[model samples]
Target: MESTSPMRLSFEIRQMSPQQKLPSPDVGGMSRSARVMALLGLQYTRPFHRDALFLFFFALGPAVWLSMTVLFALQPSPRHALWSPVFLSVALWQPLCEELLFRGLIQGHLLESMPKQKTWLGLSISNLLTSCLFSLAHLANHSVSWSLLVFLPSLCFGFMRDRFGSVYPSILLHVFYNGGYFLLIGSATR
Candidate 1:
C-alpha cells in the first residue's frame, strides 16, 4: 500500500549496510509548502545542536578562512560599501537560498539517494559530488580561482549539515561566511 502520511525527514547521512538503501521521505500527506521544502532538503524535524552551530560560527569559520587564505591567498577587497538594504540580500538572503538549495536540497537529496561510501578519511562520495557541483555552479560570476575555491566551503557546509543532522547550521554558516567576507571587502577597500 502507498503511504500518504506527512512525516519528518532527516538530513543527516546514516551509516547503512552495503546493500541497504535509504528510505524515501514521507511527503504524501505533507502540505504543499512542506513538501516543497522537503524536496529541497529543508527537513524541519531534524535536531540542531548548539555545539555544532557554535563551531560553525566561531571555530570552523576562522579555521576555514585561514586555511583557504593560505591555500588560495584570497583577499576580500571591496570597491565600496553599500549601506542600502541590498547588502542583506547579498550577505544573508542569497546565502540562505544557496545553502537551502545546495547543502539543504541538492546535497540532501544525494545523501538520501546515493549509497554512503567512504571516499576518504571520512568524506562520503555523495558529499564529494555535491561539493563539486556546488563549486561548479559558481563558475560564471566568480573567477576560475574562486569557482574552484568554493568547493572547500561547500564541503564544510555539507559537513555541518551532516554533523548537525539539519541544514540550519549550514545556512547560518553560509550567512556568516558571505556577510563577513563582503564586510571585509567593504572595510578594506573603502
Candidate 2:
C-alpha cells in the first residue's frame, strides 16, 4: 500500500483537467464586493424576455391596484394634480432608489450569507427580513398603522426581486404600486 502526502495529493488535483474537477462554491476566488454584485444580479439571467415581463406586469398591475382601490375606502386628495413633481418623484424616483437599496444591496447581502432554501410561507428568509426593514423604514414618515400597511406591498416588491433575480422587476412593480396608490388613494402631501 502507498501513502500520499498532503502536498502530493494537492499537486495531483491541480493537474486534473477543468472538466475532471468538481465544482466549487468559492465563486472562482471572487472578491467580496464582486460576489455581492453577482448576488445582486448585476448580470441578467438567460431567457429574460422583455415583452413577456412587461405584458405580465401590465396585467398584474391593474388587477392589484383595482383590488386595493375597492378594498379601501380611500378618496382622492382634493389637491391631487397629475404629473406634479411630487407625484413623479413618489412614483418613479423613490421606487428606483428603494429597490436598488433594499432588494439590490441589503437583500443581496443577506442572500449571500444565509441559507437560500430556508423560507416561510414560500418567501425566502432574505426577502422576509428585507421586507420587514423596508416597512420599518416607512415609520420615519408614516404612522404606525400605515407603516404596517406598507409591509404587504414591500413583500410583493421583494418577491419580484427574488423571482426575477434582478432589481428591475421590483422597481417596475414598485413604480406601478406607488403611481396607482397616489393616483387612486394617496394624499397630495405624499
Candidate 3:
C-alpha cells in the first residue's frame, strides 16, 4: 500500500488531476492560517453548476426569509440590537463555526463515507443524515419545537452545500439567516 506524505498532500489545485481536483481535508505542512484558508476555500468538492440564482432562490429566498419572519413573530429574541455579544456572535461566529463543522466537516464526511446513489425522495442519504445530525446537535440549545424548526433549515443548508459543491454558499446563507432574524428581533424588540 502506497501513501503520500503530508508534504505532498497539500499541493495547489493546478497540480492535481480533475478527479482529484477537489481539495481534501489535508492541511498537511501548511501554516495555521494557510490551512484555515484552504479549509474554508470552498474548493473541496466536485464540479457544480454553482449558480448564485440557485443559491439565492433555494437557500436565501423570500420563502426562507418569510419563515424566519414567522419565527421572529412567534419567538422574538429577548435581546436588543446587534451590539449584544450574544447577538453578534450568533450573527457571525456561530454561523461560521456551525457551518464549518456541519457542512464543511459532517456533511462532507457523509459524502465521503456514505453510498453515493443511496437517496430518498430525491435527497441524498448523506444530506438527510447530516440534516438529522445538525438538528440533533441543536437539541440542547433549544426546545423540541425549536429544534424541529431548525431541522428544516438544516436541510436547506445541507442542500446548498451539496448543490454548490462547497460550504461557502451555505455559510453565507447561514450568516444571512441569523443576521436577518436578529435584525428583525432587534427592531421588533425596540
User: Which candidate's lDDT is highest?
Assistant: 2
- Give candidate 1 regions above 4 Å deviation: 1-35, 45-49, 52-57, 63-83, 115-119, 187-190
Q: Is candidate 1 or candidate 3 better by TM-score?
A: 1
Estimate the TM-score of every prediction: 0.67, 0.68, 0.65
Top TM-score hit: 2
Arrange candidates, best TM-score first. 2, 1, 3
For model 1, residues 13-95, the per-residue Cα lDDT tens digits are 54644433333357778899876666565664444444534364545565655554544435554445544465677778888
Clashing pairs in 2: none
Q: Across residues 1-190, which tens digit of lDDT does each residue of candidate 3 receive?
A: 3232222333222233334222345667888876555444455444333554444544554455566555556445554545688777877899989998888777777766543334444355666888898888888767666677778778777766765557876777788787766665453422
| Candidate 3: segments with Cα more than 4 A from true spot | 1-41, 44-53, 56-62, 65-80, 187-190
Model 1 scores a C-alpha lDDT of 0.63
What TM value does model 3 have? 0.65
RMSD of 2: 12.7
**Worst-scoring 10-residue span by lDDT in model 3:** 4-13
